[model samples]
Target chain A: MTTHDLEYDNPNAIEAHNMSVYYGSFRAVKDVSLAIEKNRITALIGPSGCGKSTVLRSFNRMNDLVPSARVEGQVLFHGENIYAPGVDPVNVRRRIGMVFQKPNPFPKSIYENVIYGPRINGWKLSRREMDELVERSLRGAALWDEVKDKLNQNGLSLSGGQQQRLCIARALAVEPEVILMDEPCSALDPISTLKIEELMFELRQHYTIIIVTHNMQQASRASDYTAFFLMDSDRTGQLVEYGSTSQIFQNPKDERTEQYISGQFG
Target chain B: MAVTELRRQPSLLRAAFERFIQVLLVFAAAISILTTAGIVFSLVFETIAFFSEVSIVEFLTETEWTPLFSIKKYGIWPLVTATVLTSAIAMMVAVPLGLIAAIFLSEFASDNIRRTVKPLLEILAGIPTVVYGYFALTTITPFLKNFIPTLSIFNSLSAGLVMGVMLIPFVASLSEDALSAVPNSLREAAYGLGSTRFEVAVRVITPAAISGIVASIVLAFSRAIGETMIVAIAAGQNPRLTFDPTVPVMTMTSYIVQVSLGDTPYGSLSYYTLYAVGFTLFIFTFILNIFSYWMVRKFREVYD
Candidate 1:
């Protein structure tokens, strides 16, 4: 696909335009627009119930799994609106993979877990090619050294941190251009959290990563760009500020953003 | 001195009431255990008397089962084989039908459809077994005869098929429960990886819920083995060693029912044979229950 929009020199990985998400009649996320750049780590930071995760889910159309959830406006990926008629959510999810807050690995062997994405997409790879793919994916997630000896063990047998990385590897196997993470390190310990932050730095060279985090230090430490969200008077979440991480953290743009970042109130 | 003064003594009336309730609860629990023990005692006693009259070797080895006739061959294989054959046929009908229905209910059916249809499906189980017997004899047998012209009027095929219909609720409801008990995280994980609903259900949910599914099947098999009225009314009382579903056969439960019709004299070898057959049926069901328990314990996956 040719780049039609000139908003960024690097070409935006994903852009949301007047996107609003509703659960039945209750609006969860108000119209909020943001452009995520290619090959950068963008952290969405806010208190609980800010709809940051909601926007993250909308990026890959993960919210479609919920029976009551509905989307309006547009979530543009490679200049194509994902929510357009005849655009299948299944194909959208394949092109933009996700990792959840909690580590979720299939109840299968580690080898099988890595290959599951490719297998479901109907890849016809031989045994040797399959092994190579597993190794490459695991190494990309920086989990190969610890889990390579036990590829046949169940993925659930791994530690919580390892499982999250395994999920990342599983996402990487399908070769997606963008990866969405919803509080991926919230359940992890500080050490595991640090490892994930370091891995994000390593992965930023190849894949565009958008993360929703509740941890302030993590957003400041790990992300190149930061978007701050807060609940409106009606409790519908709206984006308050979006800028470079240094600017959003240190400089004042909005009084609410300053109050939220400096710990005056959530 | 301060501690002793601050302490309050327990009330005797409330303590006595609590003791009474505990005793009542223990008695209620013991009643069920005592009843099972009582049944085992009688079956064993009568079975011992039966073995005294007929040698264990003859009971195990001989092919025919005619304790009432003058020639009187006291073999058990005919009844055993008949029971196994009918149960196998019933499984053939029930397993696929029940599992497919379970998959649809758990994975495909909308909530409204599931809520409305599950009770209707369970109503099949609520139908009395005697009614199923009559339906097999009056309806299914005549229906099958049109296709298999040589089909017997009193055949195991009709009885087994009707019994399988009676058993669908047991398998479907339990299997559905197992499938639904799988965590939503697993489903989300699969869908996020780009799996279709079919792939998510078959490859992930089914395998994850396999232990419970196997347990359900085993329990349903045990229930089918112990079912009597359908086999007695439709499958006939001809005890013969055969696997042929088109022929007349008798299960162990049906044999027990046959003797309990009150024609045989009390304390006769033929009368004692009822308890022996009941004991055999009890053993089969008991083994199945233990196997199901072991299967669940061995393969159950705990999701967090």
Candidate 2:
């Protein structure tokens, strides 16, 4: 299958060209082609184990960490193929950052966690520069006011909601062009989830945000674009429908998407 | 009615059986505690008897340890110094190599490679310490003699090096387990932030697993301190105050081995020295293990 180049009114920030992600012989996501536009929140919504996370992980080539996992098609970032020969996964990831399902702050201080990305990538900032960056990133994630007094405290010391926000701050510190979130709010409480949803809306002004979520309401509530995925007969996940959130919610083209969103079937 | 009663409560017979099982388990747990207590009791009285014959101040302050020699010096320093020198050498050899092996096993190796290689590393641990003693005496001693300027035939250097080889599995296996235990999410987060494999493994993964790795190394060092065969064979039984690894020096274990091998009269002063040395060895290792426990507690990142 080839990538479907639809008449997208918005220019593409990233294009997944018939990407079939596999683990050894088993295909997890089969021939998934998606175009995520710049400055927009695109939600990959589906039932559990539908390979939405796999599709999201492929954006940063995180699936490369799994020895058996392989990607068969091109994932183009700003028109450059990420999986092409000689392309650095580190460089690809620097351009496109990710937030995991659970809040995974590094086992370090809050200040250190925010600056970890820049530090590893050889950004030799002065003490003042580091302090400012830490503040800016924390503020960017909407956690600075709550945690400014305790920047030296361990990242894991934060509440679950705060930890998730800290992870967002850590990802934001690198100044990534695209942010991929895999169920970033799945482990958060309702208030925290709402806060994160608000942060996503604000973040859409700067980053091309792609989020994988099992929550139907999160997709309908937060994302501008919603892509519904369903398991095929063979159990490999495939894209069922893609459209504006309002259209997908009100008038889903596929019956499966309607069934899934209406809680009729999963 | 019987089914409903059974669901509501366990039968008296079954309850009594469960209590019997719990008592059996508790008795099993108490056996090790009793053994430890017994060993301590045996060591304490003999140690007290040895100390009564030789003053504690003289045992500590004096630099020489030649109670069996014509001169009859009785300093613990000679044996203590030898133990320190050899154990330090063992740590030097084991720490870097073992940690690197752990890092390789945990972070770099493919799953197939890990499955085969991890057991091979454990095989190093499985090899008897007596075999290590022979390897130290014959192979390491001769090999060092060829290269080192002042390396001796029966020296602590060979014993320490070979003992370190024996201990590599302990450090590597535990550390690898620790590194692997660090949730995949942590690694993913590091990678997602553009960390290279080296960066992720060292800077991120290592920090997260430092307590476990440090505990492994410390336990390996303690094992090195207590090791008998390699030190006894390769490191000679001659007690010397010199700190040099190339010289023949008697460790506490080796001295005890030398005495136990010879038929010294029962309850003699020489026989009493074995208990005294054993007590010292016990104290040192006990302190070391306790310190390790404290350090592990101090450094634990508490990821969960």
Candidate 3:
């Protein structure tokens, strides 16, 4: 479906209704409900351990990796329930790609990393077609010119920023409709962060993007919408406010959002 | 600044104690190095003495190995060929079974199942090689002779098969560690792309850890070649060059045992032959160990 239709119908690429994440007896995220818009960079901004990453991971069931983790809620993607029984998590992941905070490039050449997804999914293209796809994906991540000549070089040989971008390229090569980035530029330098921010802007044109970040400036600079999540006195995160970037930064509906934005508290 | 602190010059006693500890550590390391060097030197010295009496060309090229015979013909080929044939059979049995066990332990088995199965498998390794030798001689050989009429009571087949079982744990444990060292992220990435678990393990994980797997195989092969007790007890002490498993054969270790147990004079060329055999076995294992280590390091995945 088109982004316009998604906006008119739901204004969200994904919606979590009354979501709660628990690690055994400990509740990490409590009663969090938020809607992320399609074709817009929706930044989940919060301090560390505020359950922002947990909620982001729940989108593609990445939290399932932790044996103790348990989730209760409806995570809707393209108006379909992702957490429903019989809905294959692998298929869900194929449609929704993830870029981790730290650059976790596969121990392989750049060309191999980018084409890994397509190759696994049985994309039987000729060598020329595969090469073209690799170039296109790298260009989409704004990493083409820098690595065009070094496709055969190891992915680990790239600089921190370049590796993160290569990871993004790897994710994009699978042709996912949504991309989930967890602090994509936190480990990078300022110049690399700016490059990533610019790439995020470009990415939103094609893919629905949801990013979790601790950098408020990055939320303001890169995101069209901002979600402010906060932990209460019990250290359980709950959604405080989510709205257009202008409204959240200019005049938040919640006082906590204002306090956080004004640097009164984190 | 107001109070003047009085400090003794660096205590000679403390300095001496620290030096003592350093000396102890250096001595410990030196002992290990020296032990290996001494063994090699002794083996080489005795082997060279034996070769003086028995020409090097005769030892390597002669096909018949009858050192204790009236004619005293000495050929190394029979012993070398027997060792290779037995080792080959042992590896053939060990490699596939060990790899499957490793896959099951690392990939398929549940935590509870692994906890129970791993130690049990290790028990096989812990059984003294002599016990395996006796079992192979009394039980396995008798059982095999019933099925295959041509099987000798003291055949290499039964001994090699039992030796393979003994070596399984080494191969399995090392391979399991190698497989487990593969990052979960790679597996997750593969799964995220719709690859099956089998596909992820076989195609990605195995290739990624190819070096470790190769090293484990080399180590298992070395273990097979150096194995002694089982072959000595079950396989006949006949150093005849033959590829037939149903026939009796002798490995290098078995030949040394046979010569040592016999009434050969200590200073005779026959007695020194033990050192020559020992030196050959030592060099073989040493080269394999070095190659395996190199392979493991060369393919190691260095993560930032």
Candidate 4:
């Protein structure tokens, strides 16, 4: 799969062209080719050890932090290969933000946590503009009403649900065009998970979202499209199926996808 | 029941051996405790004898400390001021240099480089302090004299600077451990938000591990206060309450060392001052350890 293949009337926010990731000599994810549509939620679903999270991390070049991890193919954003020579991973990550499975808000005040991304990215704003950015970001993440009274409080002081929302607000403050969430709701309660799902629906009007999750119900409920992955005999994760959520859930073409969706085996 | 039969058939010899091992461990632990208690008791006993002759008010308020001379005046301020001055100079050199090395080791160094360099860096701490004292006297003092002609042969400047080099490994190793203990999730979060490695390190990781970093600093400062050989050998035995690093002055530890090695008769006033100075050093280090513990408990960021 090449960038030209996906450059049609509807543009993709990001596309991975036969991307394979290796940790030292061990291949973790093998030849994953997918086009992430703009302004829609795409869920990467698989069992544990299938490297769905690894694939998601590679999209923003977060795997570059791991000294041994290496990417072999191209990740294209806005028709340019992000892995091309001289393409700075810092700038790549600036346009593509990420949220983790754990709500890792910095050990700072809630307002500081929201502004951290912008601050590091060197967005020089006036005090009032900073305040407005914080308010807007919090509102975008559906957390302003709960935390507006105590923006000075430490981010870790919030409940697990509120902390996850604060992380989302922090990610949103960067004004990223794409957000990669690696099981962002896996650590939250069901109510918090529902809030995140609804927030995803609202965010689909603006930014593209690619999420990796083990929850089959969540993939069906929250995402418009779903990509299912499975580990091969060599224990490398490969995409088994990719389609609209309804097609993947109701009438999966691959027998393995059906087996996985029906919980026969993972 | 089978459970009752198994309990009834339990091996008495193995149980006896387990109890014996437990008793041996208890004795081993008790020996160290008893040794510490004995030392503290002797220090307190002699310190009391010394204070009976010299009033605590005079010991503290008097500026001159010349217990060895014929016209003896007992003042602890001179030794205390010299100790503080040397330790302050040592900290000024150690803190920035050690912290930068720690950040490099923890945040920037590759796995191969860090593994190869960290142990080599730790070897600096393993070198004998007596050697460091001589290095300060012979090498650093002469080298520094080329730049600052006012430097004395036995100046606190060289002694404190060499002590700082000796303390670098202590600060760097402990601080690296603290910085490395910060969960990778925080680093990932920072980098995910477009932060460069330097920004992530200085902003997120350092602040997260600040309690441990501060505890390392406190422990390093405590070591500096209790340091004996470096100051005793390179810093001269002149008990002058001066802040000038270029001048020769005696610290509390050095004064105690001087009295211990010299022909100060047993049970004399000068001999008893050894216990007083030792007690002071003990108290200073103990307070710093307690403060480090408190800071660790109070400011630690508990990440789940």
> What does DockQ give for each predicted structure?
0.79, 0.84, 0.47, 0.88
Clashes of each: 0, 0, 0, 0
Give model 1's docking category: medium
Q: In model 1, what lDDT does residue A8 have?
A: 42
By DockQ, the better pick of 3 and 4 is 4
* Candidate that would win on DockQ: 4
lDDT of 4 by residue, A1-266 (tens): 77546665556898899999999999999999999999999999989999999999999999998889999988888788888999899998999999999999999999999999999988999999999999999999999999999999999999998999999999999999999999999999999999999999998898999999989999999999999999999999999999999999999999999999999987
| Segments of candidate 2 deviating more than 4 angstroms | A1-10, B2-23
lDDT of 4 by residue, B157-215 (tens): 99999999999889999999999999998999999999998999999999999999999
State the local distance difference test value for candidate 1: 0.92
Better of 3 and 4 by TM-score: 4
Residues B159-232 of candidate 2 have per-residue lDDT tens digits of: 98888888888999999999999998999999999999999999999999999999998899899889998899
Q: Which lDDT tens digits does candidate 3 get at residues B1-304?
A: 3333445455899999999999999999999999988988899899999888988898888888888888887787788878888788789888989988988898778788889988988888899999999999999999998899999989889998998888888888888888888878777666655566677777778877778888989999998889999999998898888888988888898998998889999898788888878887888889999999898898787765
lDDT for model 3 comes to: 0.87
Residue pairs clashing, model 2 = none
The local lDDT score (0 to 100) that residue B225 gets in candidate 2 is 89
TM-score-better candidate, 1 vs 4: 1
In the predicted model 3, the residue pairs found to clash are none
Model 3 stretches with alpha carbons more than 4 Å out? A1-11, B1-7, B145-147
Q: Is the docking of candidate 4 incorrect, acceptable, medium or high quality?
A: high
